[model samples]
Target: MLKIAMFTLAAAVTASVLAPTAHAAHSRIQFLAPSGNIGCQLGATPDGSGFAWCKADEHGWVTPQSDACPRANVPGAIGEPGGENLQLAEGQAPCFGFVMSQLFFDGQYAPPTLGYGEKRSVGSITCSVERAGVTCSDSKSGKYFQVSREAYKLG
Candidate 1:
């Protein structure tokens, strides 16, 4: 559970102006890419706030491990860490870091597929699915991220 919470916090932000009712529990909305090579999820975090993230079958290239994170596998790293997650929050920029959990993949979910030109939204985050990959972003702050087998970008 700790790891999963970390996954939700991976894109955590310090502030938000969205209404409280906007993030009510069980409001999660998620979908799988047409090819199932990618999955995306947007929902309220454990803290009662909300976030969005996605995962790839085996991401091709990701941002190098963040400097702010406690090192993992390093001789003197402070915490169990590695850049293995992609995260996005409502008011902050996305991040790549150590949050060892699968936020999107779910065998029992039967999540619908976002076709090449479709879109999905939950709260303030909206995602667009394209033939090449998926891009999810905050509608309020205009922050967002992208994920694909070939590459990723967080803006």
Candidate 2:
């Protein structure tokens, strides 16, 4: 009985000590910019007319959301959807009733590298179907940098 109790106590202590460290290690790579006010709508006319509502937030969303284009690849930086035949295209700038604002990643993103207070401008938005289902195109929402998650591959 004494040996069993000792083993149990040891195991519990070991687990408690290592649990937080393990979680922190896996918690690298954070989204850091355009961290708020994200929405999605179809290409419609002016005056917010004929606008359709899609999913608002995509953070931690496991389901895939398709983009204007069909498919894309990640970690490659710039991704062009469709085949070599059709060139990837970007819609017009966000207007009163044109491109609809879609998914958002609003939060203080700080990977282990840059730490915090680092800002990356999401230049162009690309619509790609990733393993996580359909991912939003790299729009102003995706402008980010490789601060820390570079070390780990989330795939």
Candidate 3:
């Protein structure tokens, strides 16, 4: 009887632990993008923010990773046609965690105007673990760049 009771208790405990594993948690964060172009690579480093733009007209060639540009490996490189996750560094832009993908972009706007500075909305892509809360950063559209919030949601 004693052995049977112990086995039953162990089985119940194991079931409780495994039950929670069946249900997975998810998190979603949204940020606003500028009214301008899309496909620009935007990322944040622990120190500051960084963006990669392609100057096809000026450089006579497309290259964001070249020595001339400040943000290399940000969005994409020549022949790559950059995407949201342009292999940006998360540690550098502590403000935002990492590059996820571009959620919004105005199709009407032409590639960023020269010297005018094409602004874009940038944010990170992240999720939670073990049903815990996750922190994510998003950017707001404006002249000044600021972290919108630390989105807390289920994993």
Better of 2 and 3 by TM-score: 2
Residue pairs clashing in model 1 are none
- Using lDDT as the measure, name the better of candidate 2 and candidate 3: 3
Highest TM-score model number: 1
C-alpha RMSD of each candidate structure in angstroms: 13.6, 16.9, 14.8
lDDT of 2 by residue, 1-155 (tens): 99999999999999999999996543222221232222222222222221111232323323222243333222111343321111111333211112222234333532112212332212243222222222233243332111111110111
Off by over 4 Å in 3: 25-155
Using TM-score, rank the candidates from best to worst. Answer: 1, 2, 3
Residue 127 lDDT (model 2) = 26
Candidate 1 RMSD computed on C-alpha atoms after optimal superposition onto the true structure: 13.6
Report the number of the highest-lDDT candidate: 1
Backbone clash total for model 2 is 15
Task: Give, for candidate 1, the lowest lDDT window spanning 10 residues.
Answer: 69-78
TM-score of each: 0.64, 0.24, 0.20
Per-candidate count of clashing residue pairs (backbone under 3 Å): 0, 15, 10
Model 1: number of backbone collisions:
0
Native RMSD of candidate 2 (Å)? 16.9
